[model samples]
Target: AQSVTQLDSQVPVFEEAPVELRCNYSSSVSVYLFWYVQYPNQGLQLLLKYLSGSTLVKGINGFEAEFNKSQTSFHLRKPSVHISDTAEYFCAVHYSGTYKYIFGTGTRLKVLA
Candidate 1:
């Protein structure tokens, strides 16, 4: 069984500063991972994904993630962040040769001035 772990439950950063949200998953037969962001009172929106090819994947809102096969990690990064960027981030993984999905708890990003 594989599980996803978001290292930080809450991250507080100053506006315009760079940030990196860490995510790690246990190794499995095949790796299908995704990153999603949720604004207040809104559902999750796809941020980026890693199905195959290219370890580095870019997504909307200037967000990107790099899949490290050796580390079993898909850490999200942003050169700079805005106050509007404050939201809950999540990661989903499909592993263990099953159709079932493993959803991450969430990593709350609090962008301060």
Candidate 2:
């Protein structure tokens, strides 16, 4: 079984500030990690993914994450964010060779202008 836990449900920040959204997961077998961003009334866009090799993964919109096996964590980070960054972010895991995915409820990022 695979499960994901997002540490925060909402993160509010002023424009041009850095932010980190924490995520943790547990799985019996190996899995793929993914971060998706969803704007209001829009579908999810792939932010980044950690599959197989490499511990650090970078994604669109100046986002990045480091996969830590020991801690079972994959936290998203941005050096500086803009008001446009406000959206819902989700952490998800997919079992190897399986279509089923486990997703964290979501963490809403509100970047105030």
Candidate 3:
């Protein structure tokens, strides 16, 4: 059971305001998509990926996502958000002859500067 599900653990905005962080995945085969950002102690930072062909994917500070294969879902967006984009966002999955990495128990983006 390869899985990744992040349906908001926390999201409090104020600074520039505008956010959406929700992801869902359950893989049996093809998978390789990641969105990671953890600021407050720093480590993970690879803001976007969808691996295959385009289904609307963009990365880095601005952020963007839309890979919905019949609602398997991969949702993340940032319109107007700053405060250095207060961090802690993880949604990862890797399949297809694995190196094994499945996450998504985090989504704490509190940007209120």
Candidate 4:
């Protein structure tokens, strides 16, 4: 079984400030990590993914994360956050052959202007 954990339930930041959203996962088999963002009343949008390759991965809107094998973590970060970045972010783990993605509870990012 695969599972994901989002350490923070909510994070508040001022506009143009930097932010980080922590995520961790556990799986018996190899897995793919993904970060998705859900805007208010909107569907989830894929922000980034870690399938294979370099440990450090970059995503849209200046977001980036590093895959730590030893720690089993993939934490998302942005150099500068905007009000538009305010949303519910979810971390997901897709275990190979399972065809299922286990999602975290989600972290709500509130950007104050």
Q: Please, what is the TM-score per model?
A: 0.96, 0.94, 0.33, 0.95
Superposed Cα deviation of residue 112, candidate 2 (Å): 1.5
lDDT of 1 by residue, 1-113 (tens): 57999989999999999999999998876889999999999998999999999999999999999999989999999999999999999988988468887888889999999
lDDT of 3 by residue, 48-87 (tens): 9998999989898888988887787789998999888888
lDDT of 4: 0.92
Question: What value does the lDDT take at residue 29 in candidate 3?
Answer: 59
- RMSD vs true structure, all candidates: 1.0, 1.2, 10.8, 1.0
Top lDDT model: 1
Residue by residue across 1-113, what tens digits does model 2's lDDT show? 57799989999998999999999998446778999999999998999999978899999989999999888899999999998999999999887777888899999999998
lDDT of each: 0.93, 0.92, 0.87, 0.92
Ranking by TM-score: 1, 4, 2, 3
- Which structure among the candidates has the greatest TM-score? 1
Residue pairs in candidate 1 whose N, alpha carbon or C atoms collide under 3 angstroms: none
Tell me the TM-score of model 4: 0.95
